[model samples]
Target: MLAALRGIAAPPDLPLIQRRNFLRVQIDAIGVGLASAAAPFLPIFLTRLGATSQEVSYLTSMPALTGLLLGIAIGQLLQKQRNIVRWFSAARFLVLLAYAVTALLIEVVPSAWLIRAILLLWALVTLPQTVVAVSFNVVMNGVAGPQHRYDLMSRRWSILGITMAITTAVAGQLLEHLPFPLNYQIVFSLLSLGSLISFAFSSKIELPPQPISNASRTNSVFTRLSHLLGQIWREKPFVRFVSIRFIFLIGTTLAAPLFPLYYVREVKASDAWIGIFNTAQTAVLLVGYFAWTMISRARGSRFTLLVTTFGVSLYPILVAHTHQVQVIALIAGVAGFFQAGIDLVFFDELMKTIPDGQSAIFVAVAQTLTHLSSFIAPIASAWLSDLYSLPIALTLSGIIRFLGFGLFLTLGRKDS
Candidate 1:
């Protein structure tokens, strides 16, 4: 792994600053990997804590609700800042802090109140999370510039994927071996340590000074917002892509809360099996990132997007039909491969649409749309699950995803 990282950082023509930034970004991904290892388990923890499907849905929707309200405002704020890296690092730290808080709360909060307390904690976390969401792309895009986005992100995600896979495997074993809440507490605490590493390295990333626009400062917030919206509206490609992506995202977010429910409630998967599921998915991402990067270079982002979207759209339906946990893990690996392509292509395509010097606001606009879908979809899926069944809800999600894929197939083109 070290050799691979060194090879990635070894482009002799790359500027010293960029080379250093690449290393920092890779290191930060390690921290991100460690922190994210906690992700698959959080909802599982909530389920074990006796949370309802609606409450579990809150895990996804609550964050989106905050992002829906605050994404644009935070984006505008980031655009005004001379340095967004600071905001990005700070927000990341605060978000990671919530995991530690969750760990602490496990000891003191009554079992009945624990779910509510955890929900409230994350609700407060959404403020900083919104900042992270808006500023992360700005900072990373600035660091990679237009030319190196694929190379930088591919390497970073590969590192992140491997780290997450390893740590997640370990986390699963910990959960299986230790007592209930204690095992989770330790996992959360251990994972939160990554935030310190993230903060330290991410703060060191150097980017060219932002070209701040003063025209908005003199205007009322509402007028400035209107101007920003008007700017986004005129970018036809941005509008079209964001609209299509929004539809695709509904399918994505709708399935978010249902997976753990399916794994735990429907399949009765053990903690060890859950860990294997995540590890299988994440471990394949290294190959997925490499393969997709090559495909994007050869076939273009449009082709990559269509293929990946269609492939990923099949995942929920596959899971819905399969009863075996091992088969689901295999399916997850295949889905992760396509998911990597979607991640890369989506970022590249969205960045392509933004006008120069307006990444923050544009990204915020995109994120806001994402949050709107996220806020609605998970709740709706939960309702479907409650009223009917998990398999039924998951099938609907796959259908929505296929519709999005069809739209991409028909309308997504360079000239369109």
Candidate 2:
């Protein structure tokens, strides 16, 4: 901890508080690490616990489904209270507990019904993490400012990507070496420890002052939401930007639910292999993140996003074509490279659309929409994949990317 603080304090341009924020961001990276570590293996974990492809698809949808309902409520709560650090702390703790439960009870759970129940329970446990995501983005936006948001998010993700990549690689090795259920148990154990570290780090963060008024506080949050809607409608560029984002999200999410199932069922990759694939992807992402951090600083977020979007637009096609393991890994690496850039650009652009003093609202709205899209994706993708094929779904995803490109060319042109 002292080492982290000392490291943060050494940055030339950072003030004392900025230095503290930097440490917090690094601490926040631990949660990012846990999530990333789980990402590659979670589908396999479900499979080991007797989940089918359809069940895996549904499980993938659970977090977004839970977030769709809970995210808005969390946003409203953040609007009233300024103790965001505490909210973040609570969220991490819940997520940690959830991981522990999933690790301990996964083998004992009986029937598909039990699997579904556990998934929903897992989703419930992770909802606060979603809330914490919005809070983190909102708070960080304020702290970092628009100019620095690009740099901050990039640097933070770079560090996060590095940490997560290392952890994932190590976990992958452990999985490769360990036995069936025990391997998963060990992975989840690591995740729980990471979450606890994240919680402890979050607890050290200083809370900012609340800005809501007495009258505003007394009024119903719905009325405030209505006013916010009015403002959103009144602001043409903001509306356009958000509309474009929503459209892009819909297209991007179309095949998301099927991805895990595609790898598990179609490709027939083992848990260890999946972890290795993820490690390869994260390695690519780490490189991409650092490269973009440099480019985002030089070229601006708009330019960075445009280039990255074009690159990301190609991944589905790559994924659709690949048959060999090495080819798949290469494809994944390519996707990761572009995704790092896309994420940095997306956040930077989104921050610009948020109204002053209402960062949390817009951030929450974006998150809500994202989760809603994710929730809908599984059913839609599953139906489509059943009717046509996963290739068709990928084709559809590509088309959506092209549409997003069109939006960028026409509507978002000036913003960029």
Candidate 3:
């Protein structure tokens, strides 16, 4: 493995100031990998334990709702706290318990309703992990500085993708040997162990001190929005970028809930194949993210984001046409590559166009739009899928996403 890694071309050298933060970045990358490797397999595990389609749908959407509420609250709380690493670490540790519960109950509760209840409970438990992710974004931006932000974040994601791919492959092989409930329990136990690695490495990283504050708190959403809107209005690029974010996310969410279902039901994918598909997806993401990091460092985030969004617009069409399990898995993997390129640079690019004071607010707005879309889109996708066919639903999503891409292009133009 060491020799193979050494054969890989090296990343662009970071300046001395930025280089020291690499260890923290690695730890964050590892944590993200561990968490993500567990995600694609959860619905698979639930289904094996007897969860229905509707139950799976509920499980998927419930997390988004809970994440939205908890993420907002945590964003507010972080504004007051001085130290965030401990909180971030603790949240990750606790969130693993959600998986533990699933593992523990999969054998005992074979009923669909009982399993759905467990999923709902798991959503509530998993929320803090979502909030902790905000802390990561904040800290990483600080560590990398504005100039290196996109490259640093992209590299982190590359590392995450690689780790997840490798781990999932190993887990898949191990899981193939086990049967039913035992297989799921073993996976969760391993996932929890991975969480321990995150906890341990996190404790090693030193955090920058937060500036002391002596101000009273104001807790009104409308009041916060009033202040944020004025700030965003003053910044045209920020406004344009965030609008693009909102539109793209709306289209993405419109299709997300249906993707797994389509693969499982329409394409008739097995659990092992789904794991391989996920592994392939992450592998492509790892490659794409690193490549984009190198490209965007010189070409600018706006250009890279535009190109990548165009790539993602092609995903729905590819996915729609794919009938065979292998073909679907291939398209899914390639889709992740495109998504990675967009994900790495887009937000950091958006921040480049915003005032430092307004970064959190803008991030919050983008996240809120994403979450709101998540809540709304799934029901629509479900209805459309039920009424028409999965392919039609996917094709429709592709068209809308392309429209979003066009809207993004129109952002800086006044007379268009």
Candidate 4:
């Protein structure tokens, strides 16, 4: 298994620089996986802490709010800078630091203020988060270049998936076996150490210096802003892709908070079961990434996109009908398979839409649109879940996803 994974990830005949960067990218994935192990549990922790749905929705909504405000500005700022990897590494460090802060807050903050404090901490980190979001694509695209993106990302994400699977399983066991609050505190603190690993290796990723933008340093901020808008307007493909993706993202994000809420409230799943849920999904991604990469290679990204988009649209609806955690884990596994395809196709398609030398700014525009949906969807879903039932809200999510899938069937076929 390990050898096969290596065979898939590490293709031969690369120059020395790309080879080294590829290895570094995979190692960085391990660190990322470790840190991301804490993600599924954050909302679970909030729920256990007696946080209301609106407060819980803040986890998704706050970052989106900040991203909407800061994403484009950060993108433009990065375009001006010569070394985006520096910005990428620094931003990643701060974003991961929030988990460590959350760990400390569990010990020191008053019970009444804990949720607010965590939410505020996350909100404040959105600045760096925006930087990371913008710079990440730039850095990764630089590392993979045009020819090796699928190879690099598939291996990178596969490693990340396996790492996340193991760590999340351990985290679930720790949460089940260890005492409350302290178990969480320990898990968060230890998991946060992955940030240091991420920072160290990510900082070492060597990209050729970006050519500085020549947009006239003398231009007023408004002038530059107008220029940026003009650039985006001219990229008709990017505009159309972002528009369709915005709708798809709404369906995905609307179901985000509802899953944990349903698992915790409706299903009454234990911590161990939640871990299994995440584990099942992530473990499948290891296979999914490789499988979808082959499918994309053979059938093209357009076909892959249609199939995967339609496949994933069924996840929430399937979960809505089931009450058993075991069955839900199976459903999550199915979702993970298609989700891997979506990630690969989306990244490839988005990068294809971006013109050379405009990765940061173009990706920023996309992220800003994504944040717009992320901001509205979760809160809306939470409201729907609150007003109706979890199943009803989840069914609505599937319905919306089907609509996005329909758009893909028509508009997605036009992509080259």
Candidate 5:
């Protein structure tokens, strides 16, 4: 327990903190900036290409499904790689090119059927995309060290908030002004360039070399994965932590695929409205970094998580029931404040749960379960919204979130 407690303390020196912060922030700003600007908009773009409701959900869920399938393999790769950062760069750099091509081809193929083809090609890139993403936290943990995880995470997310605020504001204007499809084409291509720059910074990041742990490659692949699972099962606290996280995750993420449709159709929100909403949320979210840090330092991550999670649940539930776009948009900004806690603490706890040199194994198991949840969440939310009312499905999501928090409060109290 004392060992785990040490994970939350500040680093011993200033120089180490600064180096990690610089490299870490560059990675965060670029990674979250690209994904938030691109992936979330995919469902919106799918609708423009004449995709049905079902098709949008399938395409949205495809990436996470790939993550679920490939996470353990990526975990093993991380275990063996001499330089994990280079491996990530290779895969993700390819993705940036794929994204650029995807954006350009939208204008090239204006046909309705051809649009579907383009989107399918886009979905196929999710494989490499998933690979880089699963390894992301492991890289951060390796670089930041447990002592600086909270500092790195809080500042990293603040950069993300700032990036999203600017990107959404700018992209929203371009989409609103430029001609159909061409607007999306130009914007996505430009965002890919931003990621290209981030990669340049990523190459300069310094990580102490990790020697390969297991040299015996004679075993079959399934044999290796089965062995990893056994090791995780031995970690009782880690297993409990992951289980509680999934419950809350399911409750909140249930609304992912439904959001674009909900905002446009039910709330009748304009493109500009989304820009304003995201900007407002980011403003609060950015300021929230300092506040959550204080809370995490004083009250502990467990308390911060429990308190803020309840607030986070309200955003979706509030959006589901409300008809006023302006009202919900403000609510969205307030909700961003709570998300700061979740963001800062979630990984802090993960880092604490495992001993040193074990980030990849722990994160792989956690992400694999999360990807599985992401796979089911949107489909369930969509089906429920269709069968009953979206309001009903979203309300139930909020209620279920409280149950997760309740369980977390009970299970996490002792260690936290």
Candidate 6:
């Protein structure tokens, strides 16, 4: 209901806002627990249905591709929204239902047509997810208030990571023990229930009145974007941060296509091995979040981001070098440690740079750029893999990730 995003009134105090944040963390635990358990396996699912590496790239890239094309439009649209929570919940509910239905269909579809059906179904279901993703941020920012934001967000990430770490560990065992398709079917079906619970918890958070967006009337969105980019560039500290993020994102996208292939084809990892890899990373996220919290508090988000990126950059390199499943899991755990830093710090850095009175516009502009890179890199990565090899692609990704470290070196001392 639209009424949900536009609540009766702002909660009168900071305590109320923090209380809402606590509720979100609880709901997130469930939703993330289930979705994380299923999402990583999606590529694996396609492989089981006989999808080629190129086709797998399409599914992997679809969310970012969708964001690249629709992020600006939807983000701009959200700025005008009075009931963002309602809008987000509605979109999320549909995505969950789609997952549930697809899970059931997986049980009945013919083996030959299954992959195509899954691809088509995936596209249709995920269309609104970009809206959900951006709006959730917008709503959370509104709910958490400025004073409590860092602490709340840090705890939220830590809690969600803690949840995924546990659930993935269990899901992996279930997948390894259960028959093919059945394990997936049960987990995918659970996605809907978890999402529904999340939506319910999300609905309880009250929002402050929306600050009206000053989207220029005469200047087209693209023209305004050009100006926003210039403004951010002039804000040198923010520019340095975004630049590092841009490079880091490229590496992440580049590494995306190689993971499933490396584990399945190269290492011959079992289902439990896959789960342990994810669990290792997620378990480390708990450490990363809290440790980064202390580090960012003591040293600042920029310093924290730069230092942790070294660990982040090592993950693909680890994959490229190792064939042993257990080492891969350990590598994942190490990567998770850095991932928490990025997860906790990235938004803090972005929010720090946002011009007062321009949160929505700033977020939209950032998403557009980030999603564009994310969209292009996956397709390019697939092409690179097709021409050379997955190993080549993974090696290249490591090199790209390391480039972020180099860029961090150039950041002005004031940024730290």
Task: Give the per-residue lDDT digits (tens) of candidate 5, residues 1-416.
Answer: 63232232224454654464455445546565664565546677776677666677776577778888888777777767767777666666666666577786786776756557766776787787776776678777766776777777776677778787778778878888898788888888877776676566565566766566663266776777687778899888888888888888888767776777777767777777767777777767788876898888999877898888888888788888788878877898888899888888888887678756766767878888888878888788888878987778888788878888888789646655
TM-score of model 5 relative to the true fold? 0.91
Per-residue lDDT for 1-416 in model 2, tens only? Answer: 79655474235476677667767767777676775576657666776677765677766577777778888777877877767667767776777666667776656676555577667776666677687767877766755766677556766776677777778778877887898778877787667677777777667766466576565567686897787678667767667766676766666777676566667667776555666667777777667876887897887666786788777777776777665667777777888888898887787778877777777766777788778877786667777887888777877877788788677767545676
> What does candidate 4 score on TM?
0.97
- The parts of candidate 5 lying over 4 Å away from their true place are 1-12, 16-24, 27-35, 96-98
Model 5: lowest-lDDT 10 consecutive positions: 2-11
Greater-TM-score candidate between 2 and 6: 2
Q: Residue 146 in model 3: shift from native, Å?
A: 0.7
Rank by lDDT (best first): 1, 4, 6, 5, 2, 3
Reference-based TM-score of each model: 0.98, 0.91, 0.87, 0.97, 0.91, 0.90
Weakest 10 consecutive residues of candidate 4 by summed lDDT: 1-10
lDDT of 3 at 236: 73
Off by over 4 Å in 6: 1-14, 214-240
For residues 1-416, could you state the per-residue lDDT of candidate 6 as single tens digits? 43342231223344655565556655655675566567777788787767888888887577778887888778767777767777777777667666677687888898788888888887876577777767766766666666645666766776677777787788778888888888888877875567767667766666666666555546786886787668667876666677678887898888887788778888889888998998899888877777887888798766887877777888887788889987898889988988888777777777777666556656766776687777788888888878987777898898898898778767776675
Regions of candidate 3 where Cα sits further than 4 Å from its true position:
1-20, 107-113, 212-225, 413-416
How big is the RMSD of model 6?
4.6
lDDT of 5 at 340: 84
RMSD of each: 1.4, 2.5, 3.5, 1.8, 4.9, 4.6
* Cand. 1 Cα-lDDT: 0.90
lDDT of each: 0.90, 0.72, 0.69, 0.90, 0.74, 0.74
> For model 5, what is the C-alpha lDDT against the true structure?
0.74
Worst lDDT run of 10 residues, candidate 1, spans 3-12
Candidate 5 colliding pairs: none
What is the Å distance of residue 54 in model 1 from its true position?
0.5
Give lDDT tens digits, candidate 4, residues 1-416.
75454444568777777777887788788888899899999999999999999989889998899889988888888988888899999888888878889999999999999989988888898889889888988899999989878888888999999999999999999999999989999999999888888888899999998877676367889998898889889988888888888999999999999999999999999999999999999999999999999999999988988999999999999999999999999999999999999988888889998999889889999999999999999999989998999999999999988998888888746673
* Top lDDT model: 1
Q: Model 6 — which ten-residue stretch has the worst lDDT?
A: 2-11
